[model samples]
Target: MSNSRSTKLHVAIFPCFAFGHITPYLQFSNKLAKRGHRVSFLLSKGAQAKVEHLNLYPNLIHFYPLLVPSVDRLPPGAEATSDVPFPLHGHLCIAIDQTLDQVQTVLSSLKPDFIFFDFSLWMPALAHQTGSKAIYYSVITPVAQALKVPSKQKPEDMTLEDFMQLPPGYPSSSVRIKSKDFETAQLKVVANDLGTGMSIYVRITSSMIWSDAMAFRTYHEVEGPYCDYLRKHYGKPVLLTGPVLPETPATKLLDEKWTNWLCNFKQGAVVYCAFGSQNKLQKDQFQELLLGFKLCRQPFLVALSTPDGCATIEEAFPEGFEESVKGRGWVYGGWVPQTLILEHPSIGCSVTHCGYGSMLMVEELKVAVEVEREDNGWISKESLSKAIISVMGEDSEIAGLVKYNHAKLKEELTSEGMQERYLGTFIQNLQGLLD
Candidate 1:
């Protein structure tokens, strides 16, 4: 079982048909390539185009496109989940499922040593057929994954109570879903049959059971207990990649328009809000979010998708809202350079949807505050304003504490050799598994 210490492995990554998932896989691929390994990134043709610029090491990491087969109800030429609405996502999954034979063909030809994948339950079997090892690479947090582990009971037969119950040997109780979120959690468990006759729970659990090993884009310091719980539950090794973030390209520059607009504000004076791609709020909720920024009475920039059924952000604004906040606030409907915006000196607080990854920051690291939601799961403008001010307020103790803790944790995560050490161990584990 001994492997040459200098051996360079070939790895293939096939993430789900979503930008959030695809982006992380590419980041991880960059990490692997940086370490002198070759990577074949398998994705849909359309998806490949969107993320091509992110392939930092094109020579070492190649993009291999797969043709997405036509499925009923999926928009013509829609390959990734971002191309269509949320309801049509299941059909997209069906389309991805139909590409299994095509993937098998590619894998057989490449014959990579390892194939990293998520959401494709058939990958393990195909990898075995192609003489490759399948690693279940999850972009989501281990806390969420551990919570959603499939039970012995059938998915359709599971109730809200059963869905709320934490998996046996789960490490943290505070991280469990709130009562208000139970309905959404229930749907994920019982009604997430992604048009492939397999619930999400089934897809995840099956992937875990069949994959050669499980991998995560996290470090032991952040998720050690959850990783341990998963390892014990699945009887397999769990590899950690320590948040595989690619170095920002030097050639990439922030657009001048954003730079000019942000310079109008003082240092740490602007509240920047962005809900990641795929979170389209209803028109009313979107307007409420805008009004919340107005209520905060601070300089702000909001970059969000036009709300559902709204053609433009202007039309969705509340009455007099445009004029009232014209000088100090800007609402943009298109994508902005989020990383640069966050790095900008004037940008103060970031309001986000608290996606799976950020949940750890709020719940575990205590680096951010959660905006209180109404009974119906909608965030009121007042609540949103309060949350923003709490962090941005000059005299707020919570803001000071969060900033200190966040800075301390950021230093630890970004310390010299932190990522390299984690990645080195991870690569060693990957080689060990093949031994």
Candidate 2:
């Protein structure tokens, strides 16, 4: 199918304040721009610098800065992952509400042909009202494998009864893990029963995102089983856009001494540890992670995100701790050379929050073995283990049921791969089934 080249196909992209959410949207717009589409990336004031750092960014890609209210109470803009204070989280919710108003107006004036939205915005209907092709770009969920036979098994299928009643090890996070769209219909019913007033905006965003025609990030070779499950059950098409990451040219800008040190390691040797943009660690949680890395005893690089006033690692962690991990690890306050670090020959594994961007990176590069946190996706642990077992250990159980099936995915990733993001498989699925 020949896609008529979009000559200045103006596209608007927006994400929440969290870096994990914001980064993927920026990467998506970048891909669109490369295909000759005019792109505008919506970002908070503080978030603009990272996107601006890209050579073709902000200048070639139009930028709309959100004048987010500087509330005194909030923590610095990071994900809700760690020990960020109550004021910080409350501020984020406030900022989100504020951005919604700003975003609505922006869409009204720019009047782009298409608008790509991340899940947190709560305003898909607003974009739709602006006469834009609202693409509900999901950073979560699995690929839909539309094969002739059922190649995957969901958690609900195997058990004696409800899988939640089973032990923690039972497999969950399937393509058929209960259709979020189908469940929302039930939620609409339950909400009506209770006579609660969750806003119409919330309802609309939920409906669009949970719809079966939404796109998935994993390539078919990587998430074949989840894709198969969805293909077998819903028959709704799914687009499979593989790993999306930004280019970091800053490493070469580093001083000679530090640059020389980075050159010494073999490719894929260092482990980069970070919770996703939303997860802020309590002081103890931060230390527990520190201890976990100390146990691993490998070369580590960590990105320690902090609130604006609470940016000090010395205050957050124990003193002289920098000396303890010196030479072995490097920790930055915010932002690191993520794609460059993962693809680095010396870098080996990563400890991450199992976020989409981070998950996509490890999956594409086969870079890390993740330390299990809350299991957000059924495929994450299975995928990470498959990617990292050679450098780490044998396949340990992820959310249970020994994904012995992951062996095939592991082999596929180690060979020729897919980095689909633009007019890739998932977008095709959306145009075919959901449009």
Candidate 3:
């Protein structure tokens, strides 16, 4: 219905049911719609609210229905989506096996100019059938560009520094960033680093080799030298959209509430803890994390995925921890507005799964990116998506440092530091692209 140059440019956006999954894609959708593109967002019953809150629901043509299996195996509310995070791994084949049957019917009915695939591996056939220009959007940074991953990131226009490299492993390969000189100097420090395993190496290899183009959620100012590194390394058309996130005022108000409570705490005094939407901490393990918070005596917010499938910050917290922390701590029973919390004046640190947006938003939120998303196979599979693969890497040292150096970045996005670079680069790239 849009009567612009891109009126016929219809884009179908699909993100998983998790908060971490939907946030980045919605940011991209808003920008695309502003650019005169017709954007259609498809959601399973689970992610319906998020679509509306982020303001993408009104723009969509239809909602995809998940086939409810006859077996009462799924938890009561979780019927529409398969809670086990396996199918979303970026393999085009597996995704098709699990979702294509339903997705195919909907896509076939609504023809569009382009299909903004969610770094989903299971999209080639659908793309081919629709004859649509497939733009694979990444929620993370670009590794093929060495922009997000932790290894020896080489600069653009910089010559190869005769570094000894690790070969790409099977199933996927690793991006080995060894500094010929830095390696020699820190051989002792580097020796103790536990590197990537065989599977991670393979997954990264596949993503870098595939994916038509990448829309990473990193800013050039924030990443600076690293963003430059990505431009030179990646083969695909790389678009670095700084912290593609929804930083709403309501979200910020909640952040202020928490910040107010932290008045007793010093600047950089609280430890904001959380994991992504999908991964779960068994009640016992979840308790241990809470125990750690108690031991650290730090102000924290831990969002939890619900027993019935919806996301809740409180349900995931220890049974009665919320009542106990009412004055001193916070518990996000559902998807907490993460970006807002990190950007708050009182927030000094974060305990997180080292997710892409989680890492990027920290710049503006003025917090550090800490914690690693549990590196299980499910995460490995999704990492094949450019967004996930590019923002974070599969290297051992990089993973550790994402945690080790987090506290160092506690200052938030500086007015003049790397943060500015990320924003300037993003605005420049998005300049006319949205017009």
Ranking by TM-score: 1, 2, 3
Worst 10 residues of 1 by lDDT: 182-191
Question: After aligning candidate 2 to the native by TM-score, how far in Å is the CA of 378 from where it should be?
Answer: 21
Report the number of the highest-lDDT candidate: 1
* Each prediction's RMSD to truth: 1.8, 8.7, 11.2
In the range 1-435, model 2's lDDT, one tens digit per residue, is 234332346778776566666667667667656656678777776667655656355455888878765555555554332324533444455555667778888889988766776544355567668866666566655521121122224321222123112122222332222234433343233223121233223332353444334455556655655565654454545455665545454554544544566676656556666655455556655655665565566666778775334557667755566788888767666656556555565765556664233333334333343443333322233344343344454344531222333444555544443454335544444334323
**Distance from true location, Cα of 173 in model 3, Å:** 16
TM-scores, one per candidate: 0.95, 0.64, 0.58
lDDT of each: 0.85, 0.52, 0.48
Error of 1 at 357 (Å): 4.3
Q: How well is each residue in 1-435 modelled by candidate 1, as lDDT tens digits?
A: 357768899999999989989999998999889889999989999888888988889999998899999999888999877688877888888889998888888889999999999999899999999888999999888987777665654444545565667767678877756566634654464446766676766777778888999999888888899899889888899999998766788888778999999999999999999887777889999999999999999999999988888888888999999999988999998877888889899998888876445667888888999888765678899999999999988899999989998899889889999999999989888899887
Task: Please give the distance, in angstroms, between residue 368's alpha carbon in candidate 2 and its true position after superposition.
Answer: 6.1
Q: What value does the lDDT take at residue 430 in candidate 3?
A: 33
By lDDT, the candidates rank as 1, 2, 3
Candidate 1 CA-lDDT value = 0.85
Per-residue CA lDDT of model 3 for 1-435, tens digit only, reads: 333432335667755444455656766666555444566666555566545666643454444545433222334445223354433222222232356667677778876555555534455447658755455565555433342232334211122232234322211132334344533333322222112211222233234435454556665545554445544455555666555445363433554555566676666555565666666555555655665565445565556555443364455566676676665666555566676667665665455554223323444333333322232312221222222222233453543454445544533433344543554454344333433
